[model samples]
Target: METQALDFPKIHAVLRTNGTGEVTINGTSHPIQADDEAAVLREALRLITDTAAHLGRPVKVTTTDPDGQGLIVVSPEGHVSEAAPAKTAPRRQKAPAAAPLITSVPEAVPAPAEQPAATVAAPVQTTPTPAHEPDEAKQPVTFASSVDQSQSPPTAAPEQSTRRSLKETSFLVSAPVLEPAAHGWRGILTKLGFRMEPSAEELTEREDIRTVSQHWPGPRTVAVVNRKGGANKTPTVVMLSAILARYSGAATVAWDNNESQGTLGWRTEQGGHNNSVLDLIDSSQTLLSPSTNAAEIARFVHHQTSDKFDVLRSDENEEGDHEVTAEEVDIAHQVLTRYYRLIVMDSGNTARSANWRQMIHHTNQLVVPVTAIEDRAEAARLTLQTLESRGGHDAELARNAVVIVSESTDSKRSMSGDALKRAKAEAQRIADGFAPHVRAVVRIPYDPALVNGPIRYEALQPATQRAWLAAAAAVAKGF
Candidate 1:
């Protein structure tokens, strides 16, 4: 395996003593649980063969267990075998020197009279010139000619001659780099003093983390828009803000930008004060004051302890008739921008509202969230169409929007066999519909954690978390 490079997609597995392990095929990870190491490997092998069957070929896997790490090749037919040992290449033997041709020797010339050795001053030591610098005074020396005692030796070339180009010269070159592995069996081997590189999955995960953790020059806003109820806009806002804050360590807040009663407050934890967007609007003047500190803004926004983000609710009073106007939206936005580096806004169902247009005006990135249901998908399409028809920054946002297609909440519980398959196919169909019209479209599997209550990142399944991370990375690229 060391002597040859395999072009097949690789699998990485690590089994722990607590009957828990992870198996990553290609770049997607799947969790495995069993009673012992044998069961773990059995499950891992099943996963490997399933992936191989899907790809219609074989795959190479590197596994780590309590004993140690090993490599194997598994085929779609369920055959598993140890990888071949490394073989050293054969050394080449040197050919014998050919005998010199027998020919008459030329007559030697008579030597000239040797003159007294001239007193040559010690060579002057000069500082070494850098590679980028042209050494004009230095000339090439030849032993064939006698020393010049009367004048300086000739220079290598005339001043008008072209100097060596920096592009052609190599300077301060380092040895080849070895990317250290920090995941799975390869990482274990590295910890044991062997050098290895990370797998493709680990590299991709690192890149996604890096993308979400980036800091732009100014405060940026993302508006999750879909002018339909139960479109998953609030969950999208919460998850995106959570991922951004958790990875970037930045001040991120998810604001409910609804004109009327919004469910964001119901879905998120409440802070000490039940201050809403209406309260913030009233205090915008004070919050915008230069003398106000950041801690004061915390009173209006609810803090999520585990998710590491803040949630700014809309007017949660059911009896309240006051709706946020465009002016109030600007007021709240200005104050929030002063305190938060990233703001993710959750919008209401009415796209024609003044507050909705105001939120769109402040958005730097647009995300459209939709469930797999037909009505939700149609609503998302109509929402984008409305924005594109405006023909300005709104159109630009619509063109660059990231669409998230989520599986229906009831599909997991009510569907099975062909019904579940049809549900997934429908989700994919919806995702495909948006793929051509938007910058990116991500399909999220149904996760019960996001169905009800405050959505926590730790409660999501591994696949759901990976999907959201990818979605967040896609949104970050817009910034």
Candidate 2:
């Protein structure tokens, strides 16, 4: 077994952005920089500590040596360690970029809105091998991503690559030594160096980074459904669209499939053109014409300028009394499907609507989103029940669905641990039933920024971005 441990050196961990790309901490702004993962990791821990304090929670982020090289840990009941920096700093040299790396994550379960908001998934288990352990047991497992060359980063391996090639062949080989940075925020008073055992928060952050970096081939449809929709569906569409577009950089679209007035356009950025799905339906003949192209079709859909997905909004005018028909939806869907790799539909409240049912029927993967509220959760349950009872393909769609339980956008303001845990349990109970019938279950914690109007992935806190990234990764598996 080759060693999986590589000296990370002084790395800078940036708070991942959704729409915008900056991470700020302790009222001081930090731009995403080109430093190693360690510095960024230290900063990330600082961000977590800051967020917990802002939420008026007792969670604390502590390091063994406040001024020495040590490890950082966060705990609600004060079970964290603190350390000081090394008195005589060890001289280190920069090593060459390590070999291409890939990670596999267990499906993550996000804590409910009220659980001190610790992390994404469990931390990458880095418990050191005991001195007496056999060497062969140390070899790690590897897997490849399925995205094409264009979508793959420079470091990503080809799809046909195997774990054997990914394994480290030289356990004792020498590499250039990299000196840890001695200045800047990485040299903060509370600097905690690296440790063999990582905190759970650190593990979740590492997993989120790997998840967001992956890419996959796709031309898939994701429906965010909740029959009792008042405001949830549009955000789900926007968030999923943003995260997917952010990570994959693939062409993605979000269509507001509301029968009547829908708020998707209002919540997202609107284009200069007042064109809606109606315009697309009227122009489908030309758009779908054999000679037509992707750029040409962009004229009808609303493009979310910041996040890279298009929006086919429903008619939002109060005076407009038009209800979309099933045939029109098929026309619009076909047109979008031709040009975009992913389409996320924000549906109306009617489960019986022709377009709504059609969405479920044609959906590649269904995403049933519910808030902690009872009525909202019930609506999600009923929608799944309706599909299960309907049989045939609908049952299959229900079976392969991804259930998402989210905190209300404004949930943080009134959150209490006991109340939050109860809400999470309820949401999990709903998710538990579908566990047998679904592909994945994702939970999203509350983010105040997403509650208002437009969502800027950049403006969200680190924790918010982590949650979204984790949820999006689960959905991307279906792709």
Top TM-score prediction, candidate number: 1
Residue-by-residue lDDT tens digits, candidate 1, 1-479:
12122435556766664656767544445577776434565566566666555444456666554333556555555555455321122221321244232232222222221211111112221222234633343221111111123333322334464567788666332333335679899899878965555788988988899999999999999999998898899889989998999999999999998888888888888889989999998998899888999899988989999999999999977687989999999999999999999999999999999999999999999999999889999999999999999999999999999999988667236456676577789999999989999999999988878888888999999989999999999999999
Best by lDDT: 1
Worst 10 residues of 1 by lDDT: 139-148
> How do all models score by TM-score?
0.64, 0.58
* Full-model lDDT, candidate 2: 0.60
Report lDDT per candidate: 0.75, 0.60
Q: What is the lDDT of residue 17 in candidate 2?
A: 16
> lDDT per residue, candidate 2, 330-424, as tens digits?
88888888888889999999989988887776688788887767788778878988998999988887777777777664533666788667766
Q: Assess candidate 2 and give its TM-score to the true structure.
A: 0.58
State in Å the error of residue 391, model 1.
0.3
Error of 2 at 444 (Å): 1.6
Cα RMSD of all models vs. native, in order, equals 21.7, 18.3
